[model samples]
Target: MDQTLTELRTVNVIRYVTPLREGGSMPAIVEADDGFLYVIKFRGAGQGTNALIADLVGGELARALGLKVPELVFIHLDEGFGRSEADEEIQDLLKFSVGLNLGLHYLSGAITFDSTVTQLDPLLASKILWLDCLLTNIDRTCRNTNMLIWNKELWLIDPGASLYFHHNWSNWKEHILTPFALVKNHVLLKQASKLNEADVFCKQLLTTERIESIVALIPTDWLKDEPLFESKEAQRNAYTTFLLTRMQHSDIFIKEANDAREKLI
Candidate 1:
């Protein structure tokens, strides 16, 4: 287990309130010490442990893969909105099954829609796509636009839909491929000298050993006796295996990205 994950377990001062927003999953704004705010998310009712595990593992793995993901921590609360009248209004507003505060990225200036793929740096987009492929992330589509740009650096959010591939891994061939379009033809790709370096980044960052090490940090109690993964060891092994298999196939992705860059000529 990573020591950081070990240290995360010690954060016992979680406060709950009605979420500022809710969407695919419930989300609330939480005020932490040092004026840092985090968006806390809870596992929906009967969704089982998959949602929690996906957030933890997928977030950590993206960090491991040299992508920017929000810092995540596990929190405990004695009571949910079911116990408070103020929280009840939040429940009525969002109707989240579990009580938790989701972190908010307090951005300065104004939030406006970035309308074109060319508006973003292509190399950064390629890196995000590579990390998504490594994790089998399928939610970062054109419609959702999950990537956020702050100070010209790309940060990934809402990875709750990754990892399991939403049970659609077998049909990857039918998926509309978009990363190559941006990488191949976008002008930003021309400016990004480091775009070609992502293959090396992928190799160094997504190693099987590293993936297993992070997976070990998943709290066992949360997954107690879950049938999908018999034990933590099994879960770690499975994730490691998936990474290894994906790495073997990454050459095609890398080659396509390179070929796309070449076509920009």
Candidate 2:
């Protein structure tokens, strides 16, 4: 599965659907011209385009690591849409989001995964744990797994919380090796196995070219005006540098994860 995935397709928002007010970002379920429903993350949301950047990079990386992820796409919004009757808050959100937005394919009838009620294969659990650590994802705890069980398989979602360094560029270099301590509380930590093996697999698979491919998926406008970066490509390169450099310290994260796993046992 080392092949590059096709670039995400852009679709026009054919209809303004209901709001899915689960997270702070105010993502909505909208119908696209492709006749498919997508969970679109609006640029007007709290995290703004940076959250979309994380979703593209993290989701693509997860897929490359052989984990299931909803197909990522660009959903175009229109200003006139959703102008009619609606909650004032949602009306404001839709109005501001009159441009390109990040979307994850909607999984109809999919159930939120509850790790407590179900068991997961140790290797699969380890793979997900390793992926989350690589991305420095702090949002995958039991309190909010951010995963869906569709057709009895776990699909990872919501990687917008990673790359936290972007939010504050000062001393960003220090974040590369920042050990992912929050992983100790991850919902699937107890079920993880072969932690060291998972690290090696990710390090080998998540190469520079692969990372570039993932970053390239992000539109240029989204990377603009990023602090400490002059051009869009510069910001993109910063992400590549961070992830690639972080891989050099994979053992530190692996050891931290294993230590936490021991505490769980």
Candidate 3:
């Protein structure tokens, strides 16, 4: 474990609360102390240990990818509140309840997919696609646009569906090959000059070393009995390979956007 993670456990910033929503693999929410907020996720025996590891690994990887994800930490508590009598489980449930209450009264402003990303912003759309590709995130679809926009910035939330690629990876590949027609003719891709800037940004953010490091930080339990390579190093290499492969496929969409732009002119 990283030393920073150990120190983060000691901070008294986290407060467990009740859930605000119910769609994620595990229930969770952000508890704030003063102005700072910490994302707290509850792990019950019902979810099993593997799910907990997935959450931690996915959260860490998102942060490494330069995406706007909330800060996460494990909050410990005494048993007797939920199943297994484990303090960890009890603390998680408490935090979830608190988060639900807070979101209901306070952060009532909600943004839906109908108004998220406009069809004109092909460059921004491409950037999002590239990030999703690198992370093997298969849940960002038309109906469940998990990305939220508040204060003019995009924030990623509810990643409980990522990393378990065995379930949705095939669906993701099908979509990537066909491409989303709506974003194909976006204006941002029309300007070749703008793509150079986006390409640069992507290159800077998704480095091989950083990807490998993030994969290493994922809890080993999440990969249990999965068809992936046995060793951690091998698993990291495999994940990196998957990300690169997805990026290659995404390039075709970018090219299509460029072609559409040329036709328009």
Candidate 4:
């Protein structure tokens, strides 16, 4: 457990159990020295470290906002841990990711949240929907909620699609006031009856200082090779700046959410 990173723990991978190839990343279930199973996010994943960074920051923000999220850890990959893997893909991924990677503690027996089969408290739904809007996350649609149900509670997962500004920082200004109209397609949109309230609460929590701290959580190794920024520090500044600006204009998104809610409800 690194003291600098606060509550986020660090664990070493003990064994690679299996590959979860549902997504391009091909994250795997690996047993950690901590005696827990974690869905490992490989650095070699197609999206590269961008996806891992997004997952780390977005999931942490969710937890900070009192949303249910799985425990995230920094898992150190041993040099020879995946050498004996039967799958060439997994072996290659493991070889490339023989360093630090992201891991979500596996929630055994957790079921995927299906709106048709379950209903969430309106406030919870609004809070989640608001966070997605704030992060500009485009992956939480009905077709792909990226959510799970464990212990009879909704838990967020797979936040890799967030912080879109990093992908196209060229005209990030044009994107700041960008209306997240796609939020209407969000899985929780139907149940987010309190979007306005959620917006206020989240805006208060996501202050500039908080945004800066969250961006600092990104690993330095992941901040390299950027086409837009000159250095990792610059990249970190860009993230916090983008998020701080977005937080200022949250009303734009809140209105978009409420407008969408009006049509749905």
Error of 1 at 237 (Å): 2.2
Candidate 2 local lDDT, residue 129 = 89
In candidate 4, stretches whose alpha carbon ends up further than 4 angstroms from where it belongs are 1-7
Worst 10 residues of 3 by lDDT: 97-106
- Whichever of 2 and 4 has more TM-score, that candidate is 2
**Model 3 C-alpha lDDT per residue in residues 1-265, reported as the tens digit of each score:** 1212221232232444544454544444445444444444444424443444445555555565565655554444334333432566444554343211111112335454343244425556556554544444556665676666655565566555544553433343344354334443232333233554555577666566655565565445444454444675565455566655655566665555456556756
In TM-score terms, candidate 3 sits at 0.58
lDDT of each prediction vs. the true structure? 0.54, 0.86, 0.47, 0.86
Itemize residue pairs with steric clashes in candidate 4: none
Stretches of model 1 off by over 4 angstroms after superposition: 1-10, 17-22, 33-35, 45-48, 80-82, 86-118, 165-196, 224-230, 252-265
lDDT of 1 by residue, 1-265 (tens): 2323332432332445345354545566655553555666655423434666666777777777667776776654334434544555554433443433223343433232243543555556556666655565656655565666666666667666656532433443333322333334332333334544766666776666676777776666545353566665675566566656666667655566567656654
Pull out the clashing pairs in model 2: none
Per-residue lDDT tens digits for candidate 2, residues 1-265, read 6567688899999876788888788788889999999999998888888888889899999999989999999889988776883688888888877888999999999998898887888888988988888888989988899999999899999999988878887767898998889889889899887887777777788888888888778888887585577777887888888888888888878888999999989
- Candidate 2, run of 10 with poorest lDDT: 223-232
Report the lDDT tens digits of candidate 4 across residue range 177-226.
87799898999999999987888788777666666777888889987666
Q: Give candidate 3 regions above 4 Å deviation.
A: 1-15, 24-26, 30-39, 42-66, 74-122, 167-200, 248-265
Which structure among the candidates has the greatest TM-score? 2
Model 1 — TM-score against the truth?
0.68
